[model samples]
Target: MQLLPDSWPPARRWVQVALINLVVAALLGALMRYIFLWEVPGVEYRNIMHAHSHGAMLGWVYLVLFTGYVLLAGPARRVYTYLFWATQLTVVAIFVLFALQGYSASSIAATSLHVLLSYVAVALLWPDLRRRLAGTVALPYLLAGLGSIVLSTLGLWALGIIMSSKPPNMTLFYLAIQFFLHGQLNGWFMFGTLGLVVAYFEKQQLPLNRPRLRQAFILLLCSLLPTYGLAVAWAERHPAIYAVTALGVLLQLLGVVQWLRAVWPALQQLTARLAPLLRGLWAFGIGSLAFKALVHAAVAVPYVAVMSFTVRNFVIGFVHLVTLGATTLTLLALLHGQGLLSLRGRVARLGAWLLLAGFVLTEMLLFLQGLMLWLDWSFIPSYHTVLLLATLLLPAGALLLALRAARAPASTDPGAQPLPQYAAHSPVSANGSADTAANR
Candidate 1:
């Protein structure tokens, strides 16, 4: 399991490049917040915001998941290398074009290409991953993820039609976003991470309840389609839709709890092996997920659904809660699990802590703002400056992480490794510390 460059391990290069994307996206996000505070602008806010969101979603998240896939199935697949670089090209093109002019001719073309490339990724991955992953219990989760990705494309197509039409359907635009986000958060991100977690447990010869995990997966899949009604409820204003969506939200919550229970024992085992910062990531990431499910289900009430969409603070806070709190942290944990991030040394430790601090502070500010709005405070003073400064921590941490990766030695080692792949299966004590053999 030693790193070798001649072999061109996809884990090293792809993840390195992905971390750069993460830093860039964070910088773009910070810049957006900066303008909101100071209004210093050469570039348009909306256009740059487009770049920020697209870069964060496609550039960082998609690329990281692609790296995780390669890690799980093995890096010997050639199509993966092709998909990796090709998608990077698309991401760069979209980000540049969007920053210059939001959804202008070039940006529109790039967006179209991004959608096509996603399908291309799935097409290239399915045959190869399915083959190598055969007979593995986690294979279904992986394949379901790919399928969800392709299914999510329907939203992009819907968006394109709406945009191209003379009078764009504004309602459909939001609906499309909901479609993409729901499928992605629950389908691609959750399933992919779950598969990797299961694979890690398998490597450790840990016991898992496959039936329970699969039941969770199935419930999520069933609930996803109806959950779109939760978003659509804003426009439709139908009580029946609210009822159905409430049921879907409840099901999603139940499914997650089921999956979490199945993983709890393994997570306790894995937690003791992780660095403290990484352990914090697992705690916050999974904790936010439970919070999200509860909040999302709360929208089963018709008035709450409208408020969630209409209130700027609530909207932004929830979106960041999903992207940064749930997806980003989970992705970081999986990346570390896959051995791409060393997660040792002061540099890595500092970077992780800074990112966590940034996230917590930003969340606090956002939640406070939302509280102000809910309580009829009209607005919160100095909110913009506080948010802008808080946002800076994200990029600062991301940059340090990239630097730490750059400074790390070419090959990883045995005893000095972070979360060694085959650490002894000794039991963990009640205090969450590993026993002697596992620690050594």
Candidate 2:
């Protein structure tokens, strides 16, 4: 019910547009997957893929962050809306131009414009968000997320510089992409969204192990920069970088363990109160974090490191795990918890389930293919068809979500009953005591 946005033409449109963008991105992805069977005139594979990824990142993820911030934290300065539109325009331009020409002058200009807009976005939004720093763990993570945005620009600039030269250092180009990817995926989207989730708990006065929460935060925050080495390890065979990556892996594992121990119980209790759809979303999202930490640990190994990056299927599968499973679902849960989506609403629930199912299937296909390649097994027959079909559900879900989101009532029913509040000092079941303590 009117949870996010206080902007012109209704804040709800922001959400609707964002979801619509998601639908478009998913469609683009599906098209790419299916292109093998159906050739589209004048379409380039890499160009469309660029649109797919950039659309998801900038159109969906970036816009959703803005929606959540305004929804949960309340209104900020006037410049917020202006920056929001400008950024959206740039994203659209890049997506369209890239489809026309891969890394051409037009797309590059649009990309540079986006990078500039991103800087302004962080600058305008950061001060307003500092209040989020007062007590909850969310603020610091958000700050780090914004910092990642800026740091990513350095990579962007570096890549631009090299691309202009007679012969670009391909390794350097990849390093630039790595910096941007790791930061955007891990730093900005993951941390920022997770922080908001914690803030919601704090707001609800939910039980948590506050000390462990702090530990997890510290461990993860401290590990963030060093973890860049994992991305760097992709290009560099330097022993020192690998060693640093190993350390980052350990820290990440510790952080994740601390986080799970601290919040898992509270989360369980909370999910018990949530609707089935919400629970599924939570399962997809939070569970991905646990699995991702384990995967990161494994990937950190010296033997596995090269394969993780070198294998195209592995790379695609891994990226989707983060984007669809972890980032998108977690943010969706946040939206539902913020009262943006109806837990019992048929359209929303159906859309969420479809998205989850699609993600699962897509990952399955990609990983299966990767495994085949790794073991020297025969390729999966009609692999392209399988991926294409799996990927289609993503957009299908997004379309339903966007349609219903657009039709969503401005607010929840006036007669709707509110769930009983769980006061900070309230007693939970014996099982939850440890978790409640984490909130202290």
Candidate 3:
């Protein structure tokens, strides 16, 4: 098989880097667990956790997805190969430097590199993304979500620099975290999910116009209300601002309901073969809605007893469930679209079932743990271990799915052709490349 492409050289590199980082992160996690089991004291768990988070989120998840998009989405004027490689290099440097030197001068240098590379990547991809939105009803919402990513990245970069400085201001760090959280949770994850759903439904010739418009409105409201309320609450430190934020939270919950209503008709028509993946996405949406509601309830109560467990559930249980579970499922679906995976076969079906089970169990355990903590109940170390072990199923399932995809034959659609064995031989136009290769 042809190996390299003149225009997509970075695509392969990106995948390789992402996989390496994932492996490293997993190894680090294992090491940490072993050390903890050995009763190591002053083990600097927090720093290791930071490394793991950075590696997994930025290095593995984002990089791999972006790389896949580059390879599968085909050539666009904006997305040159060099820029992609530079961005991955910057991300890898950030993780390595952070681990070696802690959050200091090296971290600042690495963060600066990442910021610069991120800007370049965004600039390069903006034109193609804008083209994709040309006549879509949800164009404005899509643009707004893109804007959120830009704003969030800037905030994240600022946070990184601040974190690297000596005698860091804890309050500023907290504010930075808040900004980072909002940007990722609201701007990137939420918008990305909605955009993907709309895109997929439209491609499938399913009814998406109404739901797209409705979701756009809800997301717009969600973007504005909570942002304003959170700013006011932070500035004033008043209970009233909290209440207003809670109102915004309720609005978000309403948006979720509207989303479900919009998609329910299409979901109802899914074949038995597609049910598992569809159900996984549905679970994610439900979890997202529940999380939003819980946030509102927590804000209203504001008492430690009532708020703590709810807050943890929203953050760790709900947020993570939707994020890790839904996002992965969506990514897998997208990959399938690219002809990277087949939804048919015993292995594929078993993998899907295992993944769904793992996600549900892990999320449930996480919520249970949060409740235990809130109630000051006795810790169940064994239960925690089981949860961690259960999480392995997700990756295991993913690996199996990947193997299936790798073994599947290329699409035989009349309009489609097999992907060029070499990147250099691939068609330059997105339509020619994608539609000629896969229906997705």
lDDT of 3 by residue, 259-310 (tens): 6667666555432334456456455544544554455445544453234324
Clashing pairs in 2: 4-71, 208-435, 208-436, 208-438, 208-439, 209-437, 209-438, 209-439, 210-438, 210-439
Clashes of each: 0, 10, 1
lDDT at 36 for candidate 3? Answer: 44
Candidate 3 stretches with Cα past 4 Å from truth are: 1-36, 39-43, 64-74, 160-167, 209-215, 218-221, 224-237, 270-301, 304-314, 343-354, 398-440
The parts of candidate 1 lying over 4 Å away from their true place are 1-6, 378-381, 406-440
Cα-based TM-score, every candidate: 0.89, 0.89, 0.76
Report every candidate's CA lDDT: 0.74, 0.74, 0.55
Indicate the worst ten consecutive residues by lDDT in candidate 1.
414-423
lDDT of 2 by residue, 147-260 (tens): 878876687788889898878989889888888888788778777777777767665556778888888878887777777887787677898998888888789889989987
Residue 194's C-alpha lDDT in candidate 1? Answer: 67
Runs with alpha carbons beyond 4 Å of true place in candidate 2? 1-9, 407-440
**Alpha carbon deviation, residue 200, candidate 2 (Å):** 1.3
With candidate 1 superimposed using the best TM-score fit, by how many Å does residue 118's alpha carbon deviate from the native? 1.9
